[model samples]
Target: MRARRALLGIGAAVAVTFTLTACTGSAAPNDGAAPSEPASASGPMTCETILRPSFAEQLAELGWSAQQSPFRIGEHELAEGIQCVWGDAEHATDVAQMYGWAPVSPEQTAELQQYLEDNGWLREEDGDVVYLTEDPDVVGYLEEGEYGMTYQFASGWVALADTKESLDLITWRG
Candidate 1:
């Protein structure tokens, strides 16, 4: 019960944080880009069973492409080759803070980076620091603190984030 209350409190704090920022998904387009995601329906709401097919279709609708070989880290799968990119932030690095898109403290960034590293989602660098994945194209930009969010699509599995902050708070990582 206490744990549940704490969880609820954290969720409320996140909501308040965003409400104060008043940011939207209106940042610059991601890359040279492809067709934009449908305003009303970006794609579909997916889960473990429907992740792959739904994700592929969503990216396709949004202009992101996939490659044959996919990256597998633990239970999560990653796709490669970006068909197209679109977001307010240019590169993955600033997908969140470039504008009021999604604000994150430096401490949150460290917490998130460490979380990914402790888990299998990140790769070790020189035995100490860690990165999201092996692909250079797979950069980190959309970061969510504590229960952090990351966006790194290689080829197999990718989850689209509506906003930089949304990427951080994604319910599903793989």
Candidate 2:
């Protein structure tokens, strides 16, 4: 019960912070990207089932192509919790990955933020998540418990823009 109360308090704080940041920040641009095809899952949502097909189509719309082979980090055979990548064909530039975990506590989230910040990732509040990225292009991660999302950009600013657009299209959807 105490832990639940603490989590509720933290969640309220996050909501207030997001509201203040959204009110202060410049309005995000309307990119006219299509909303992703609605994702459906029987069990826990995995990266492959939810992220790939929609993101592939979204990337194609943005003029990028998907690589055939995907790399993984964990021992698990399941691809999503491990990692998933999409990139160009010839040069192998412009890549993105999606994966996340639920922080055990607010302190863990803070430690994660500080670690990323120490590594030179600038932090910004987007909705309920604090996103970390560098300038000129938005390539970074937005972590909120079980919904953390990370991305990197190599193809340049256009790819970064498309990434943000696609994220906006799909982030809220189930």
| Strongest candidate by TM-score | 2
How do the predictions measure up, each by TM-score? 0.21, 0.38
Mark the 10 consecutive residues where model 2 has the least summed lDDT. Answer: 153-162
Question: Clashing pairs in model 2?
Answer: 94-155
TM-score of model 1 vs. true structure: 0.21
Give the distance in Å from residue 25's predicted Cα in candidate 2 to where it truly belongs: 26
lDDT by residue (1-174, candidate 2, tens digit) is: 353344334334533544454466532322222235423433444433434344445445545543332222122221222233444455654343333222123554455556656766656664444555443333223323322233321111111112232333222123
- Local distance difference test, per candidate? 0.32, 0.36
User: Which structure among the candidates has the greatest lDDT?
Assistant: 2
Q: Per-residue error at 18 for model 1, in Å? A: 27
